[model samples]
Target: MKTNINNLNQKSIAVDEFFNNALFDKKKGYYSTKNPFGKKGDFVTAPNISDIFSEIIGIWIISTWEKLGKPKKINLVELGPGDGSMAKILVRTFKRFPKFYSSAYFFLYEKSDLLIKIQKKKIKIESNKVFWIKDFKKIKNGPVIFFGNEFFDAIPIKQFQVQKGHYLEKFFRKSKYEIKEFYKKAKNSDEKKLRSFNSLKGLNFIEYPELGFQELDKIIKKILLLSGGILLIDYGYLQSQNLNTLQSIRKHKKNDILKNIYKADITYLVNFNLLSEFFFRNNLKVKKVVTQKFFLEKMGIVERAKILKKNMNKLQVNNLERRLHRLLDRKMMGDLFKVIFAFKSNNDDILGFD
Candidate 1:
């Protein structure tokens, strides 16, 4: 069954609720209605930019599995696997390591039904090896490795601002004339929760992942019980900055967020520092956060690219070089994107962090 985010007829809803309906309403929502990947779509992901990116992730998975003592039945879940581009390559890359491939069960934890259909079409494997799920209740097993590229940012979040010792939460009230943003008195509980987090201190503006945390709460429970980790790579900041990063992008161009409600991709930057704080609070060990460039270089993406270039023609080599630069260049995804891993284990030797 599809995750219902239907707040359509309702006159007013919270910022996160509006995002949920706009991006994932199961009908006419951006993700539900169209494919938002590649040149034809709103924007392209790293996997579509280059397969080597996914290959690097595939390599990381194997190495991490080894660190986990090679569990007999390891569960690898890709959170919010967009377009299934990365997961498709991961499944193929795993085939080379036959032992690991057979031992691993691939799970795509997705919410968008349209994307799920697209993913199923792209990953045409006829085996019990792969599955799609909305929750973690089914995976009652040895260990679970949950990873996602550009996942958490897509989850809806609540935004707030502090004014003259008064706390107010942002909401989008869809009135008959037009849709506009207005601030309402925030809940006392929300204010208290914000104050409780040390990572969110001294900020006039706040973007709290209210629903996002609820989602992670489930995953955190699974990790504590199963002894595995979650690796997330997304565009976010490690420093505590009071900037509103909420954005709407379509065809690689930014539009006023409220302008294109259910037509454009809505997303915000993930706060790595906040994530670290939350993970620690949940009793999970977090690896040192690193840039995409740092993580990929440590994972040997440069070396992998060199090996691929040798077998390619001049044109192919040039294309490969460009793609590699995009992935590693500080001006592009290299510096803007960040990598973080949180696991419930004594082994902090996971690759791509140090």
Candidate 2:
């Protein structure tokens, strides 16, 4: 996890190392080369599925700002903004609230230049309003809100297997014929980290997001310096299942994790319980984790959909309903996805969590 090395020329590389290369290698990474959103792409996200979803999130941001006493200057950083579609919709949604829109500065925190280019193309409206930052150092005056949709899941994860009271970390080694799996003794530091988390107890297989936590360390520093929060909405579990959830998506279908290289999207499910522990361990307060359905319903997505349906034709209405089902039905993304908020503020009333 310490190295950015992606090439398999080495004898072996940690799981996170290889996974990071799959999604972020400068020349051959999946995100560095393509726009993996929408029907033609591997899979679609909630924001792309419906404008109502973005609108609801926008409203939540505004409410959150209000709870922070409506700061004259505020920053909203959308972490790893995919194709900038959500931020694009957010720009339009913010405009409706002139006070928030004028004071708000949108920062799409993306590392991929190719994805940034695609985001810039989609968010051409009010070019000045949207800015891209590789990090969060320049905005010194305002409280910042760090938000990510399906963001943490994409961050590379380190896999470990328990072996007779010892830990063996998983790695990928490349041969002339193909890439293969191997294991090495776990580092002492990683073992110490695992011991600190109660959620990880009694697990034979572990998918620890060491790299993702490193990224969050940066975000956590900003939240502590400023006064706002970090809200993450992603598909994950509240409890650790003690199973390896790593998988790939290609052409809207599941693909072998080792076969596709950088041609497919690679990810592991986020563990909310572990994340909650992480925030608390960092001295930040965590709102109780809630399902995406509960959060959106509290934020009024259903009501927003009703309002939009009044103006649409039958076919359009059906499509809208289908999108809502995907987003809110318990049988679909509703129960499968979760929302978590961590902050350094006194106001405990985090919108949509109550």
Candidate 3:
């Protein structure tokens, strides 16, 4: 199951293929090899920064379920749940609503065997309520409150650049000189979309997440049938700015993505505009996208911090405060990360949107 990417001895792969191998080749993928979270890891996520993030999410879930008349069976799905930090926090919070907790079945969509082991260890207390899956298709029916935090960005992407009258895709090469070069012409809908976007005037490069869109499409189809909702929180652009946000992280620092290959965490910024459009066209209602700062504020992060502070000593309070600012400061994740909600029903007033 642990396939070495280098063993394939392939070259000039598509950008998607490169990323797919680098981040999720099953045996040697980034997630499979190590625990990439917290201070000890390459990068820390919002949940790792503080429990407030998951607390807010937990509040949203409970409130949304209440608005939906509290379904007897609900699928609480989390995609790419790294380290199981968010699930642990959210599960603990959900327990406050005994009836709701009893009605919920926890499902995690994770493929990395190594990370799955870590997740299993972290959520051992809730092991009976949890289930690991590679596909969401198995969640037959009923309402599903899906959570995808920093999920879309890690999926493979196809990079395209405009030249003359056509769009050329950026592909890799095994040759030393052209190992990281773009020299192929894109076709089909990739060409079509590039042309259409170009007709609007002034566009050069674009990274398309075909697989990401496909995944979203599948999830939406199920959401429509089940009458549930999805909440996605990640660093991305509200508009398609034609900038390549793809980058690599190693040991908590940015590295040249072309050189690092499978050694680092590779990611791109999610395009909220593109996703919102898809949700809208599918007849799903999209909530106003809110920054992490605004979302946390609306969810009472400040109040939660105050209550927690009352129980902490000076040193503990200081550490907690720093974590809070890291999560909410405009200079930090607050402005860069946004929260998006798309749902099947318009009746339930989702919280943390205002």
Candidate 4:
């Protein structure tokens, strides 16, 4: 069953169909055609916000490298490295530790050829030390240090809502305009689990268990086989609960998620509780789960801000302070974002705060 919206009056398409077409289209997916980033793009990530963000992450990665015994051949893997800003910062910082830099092999798991070009231009790691792959499975075994910032939210999610005492899966149908609703009753046990999770009266929840588990399983299996760790940073909650977090952003402003299917950035808040549970169930050693604010504060963001401010004028200092607050303030991204870590080695305590 395909819904054709080519003749529809509405400019927007259904979210699911839109993503399917935009990302998986055999001929012309958006990713196949363009680079999405910066002020003109749909949204900005932490690495784009400031070098400080990636520098801190680099520091943590270096510490983790030491904990992993500074393996001679370690894979420093990043998923969805936007514009390569984080990778650039990481490589620059890693250079300070020549031993680690010499041993590390940078592996980027990215899909967009356009963005990969941008990343190549932005990051200047040794050509021999860096490589790119579309899938994680292709990478051979090694001590791995994985980083995924705001990557999970972008993976397509199955939105659902409980109604009339039954769990209904949402689908989009194209007509005059793209229409969306609980299109059908879920039949599979997985769907049943989602329905049960959403059954609480007056509660609405969205689940991405399939995407979440698949990624987790892939990384966990690799980490289990080879000693390594994963650091995940994203906006989310510590516990799974009923709430609507699907949102769209364009030109740094919030926009209706359902209004422009392929033209804007689409994301949903991650359920860290489920992620934590996943690692635990997989028998991987859980390192830490904490808010980004707390993690940054623990990593000395305040002191770093002070040092940066010392070199700037009053106006520059004020701007730096605001940016710091925006990233760490509870009223802003502070409470909205979270950090989680899972490690194969059980001895070392993670450097980031919990």
- The most accurate candidate by lDDT is 1
> Per-residue CA lDDT of candidate 1, range 270-299, in tens?
999999999999999999999999999999
| Per-residue alpha-carbon lDDT of candidate 3 for residues 1-354, written as tens digits (9 for 90 to 100) | 222346334545777887888888766778778888989889999999888788888888888888777889888889889899998998899889899999988899987889889988998765678899988876887698888899988888888887776788887665643355656889777887555442224567777888887788878888999988888998987877768788899989998987766678999998787777767878899999889899989988999999999989999999999999999999999999998999987585778897
Instruction: Give each prediction's root-mean-square deviation over alpha carbons.
Output: 2.3, 1.6, 2.6, 3.4
* Candidate 4: count of backbone clashes, pairs at least 3 residues apart or interchain: 0
RMSD of 3: 2.6
lDDT of 1: 0.90
Q: Considering only N, C-alpha and C atoms within 3 Å, which residue pairs clash in candidate 2? A: none
Candidate 1, run of 10 with poorest lDDT: 1-10
Two-way lDDT contest, 1 vs 4, winner: 1
Backbone collision count in every prediction?
0, 0, 2, 0
Which prediction has more favorable lDDT, 1 or 2? Answer: 1
Every model's TM-score = 0.96, 0.96, 0.93, 0.88
lDDT value for model 4: 0.74
Candidates, ranked, lDDT: 1, 2, 3, 4
Q: Tens-digit lDDT track for model 2 on 148-218?
A: 99999999999999877788899888787688888899999998888778999988899999989999999
Instruction: Give candidate 1 misplaced runs (Cα > 4 Å).
Output: 1-10, 174-176
Per-residue lDDT for 194-311 in model 4, tens only? Answer: 5443223244555554665677778888888887878899988876777767777767789776565455676778888777767777888776688899998888888888888888
Q: Model 3 TM-score?
A: 0.93
